[model samples]
Target: MAYVAAAAVLLGLLVVTNLILTVGVVRRLREHTAELAALRGGGSGGLDVDVAMPAGTPVGGFDATSVADLPVSLATLGERPLVGFFSPNCQPCKEKLPSFVEYAATRPQGRDAVLAVTIGTREETAALAELLGPVATVVVESDQGPVQRAFGVSGFPAFVLVEEGVVSASGFDLAPVVDRDAVALPAAG
Candidate 1:
């Protein structure tokens, strides 16, 4: 009977220890998740455009002057916003294109307001346009340097949302204001 009692006590201790460890693990996981969410701007209240342009980091191969010369800018696009930065040779860009297209369809003014800029030759641009179909305002620049510079794009598939000649929001997702003010339009049939 004494041995049984001792065995029960040992089992109880083991279970208690396991519970404590589980609790610790759960706490750590929660902390990690919170940190990740903060880094991703998940709980950062409203959107901020400056988040897209980290200070003191110049986007490579970009020439603001040259980009200014292009017909693609906030002023030219009118009140609608533009969202895109892509390279025809980028695999990830291709993979994300479908999602971008889907998101564009949900925009207030449809895909007309969304611009997909590709840094590639005319042929490559044509191919990318074909790939994206009628889902985006495809702009093919032989040299993405100016455009990249103008938008401060340091990487492939960078996105920016411009509102009334000013950058409103920029990040991975622009779904927040896709239906506000701008004329909403449906996806291509």
Candidate 2:
């Protein structure tokens, strides 16, 4: 009888813990949605994740303004939307590339639109091109100066989806496109 009582108590505790966790998750998601909505309504400046370094913090041996100067033009990259800013050395970038590639292949917007930009030397860029294969449009920004700052990218594998010269989305969540039915996932067999 004691053993059965203990099991019942444990089960009750487990249920309570799960409920707390679920409530916390839902609250967090609501905050994020509200924040995203506010950012969207603000217009043009783009969403800035707090993780990005402050303006003066040194990165890649360059200041923010220097990083911002890497020249980019919509014309040079073609008419498709740009998915710029990543580094060859970043582990998360490496892991995420496969998903980006797969996403690009399956969705027309992704296929025609996404471009992966890497800050590396010519040889390094070539190696990355090999790594990514023909799955993405890979470009090298040998000098990270202006280019990095302009896009406000302080980390590896930052993605900005640009359409018609406007920044549509930025950061890790591709959920907007995925959820909006803009990009279709692979059909279940």
List residue ranges in candidate 1 displaced over 4 A.
Answer: 1-71, 172-189
User: What overall lDDT goes with each candidate model?
Assistant: 0.58, 0.54
For each candidate, give its TM-score against the true structure: 0.53, 0.51
* Best candidate according to TM-score: 1
Give per-residue CA lDDT, model 2, range 33-99, as digits (tens): 8876644332223555532233233222222211224333454343335464657776666666676
lDDT of 1 at 130: 67
lDDT winner = 1
Candidate 1 matches the true fold with a TM-score of: 0.53
Deviation of model 1 at 114, angstroms: 1.6
Candidate 1 local lDDT, residue 93: 67
What lDDT tens digits, residue by residue, belong to model 1 across residues 93-145? Answer: 67666767777666656655666777876676677776554766666675545
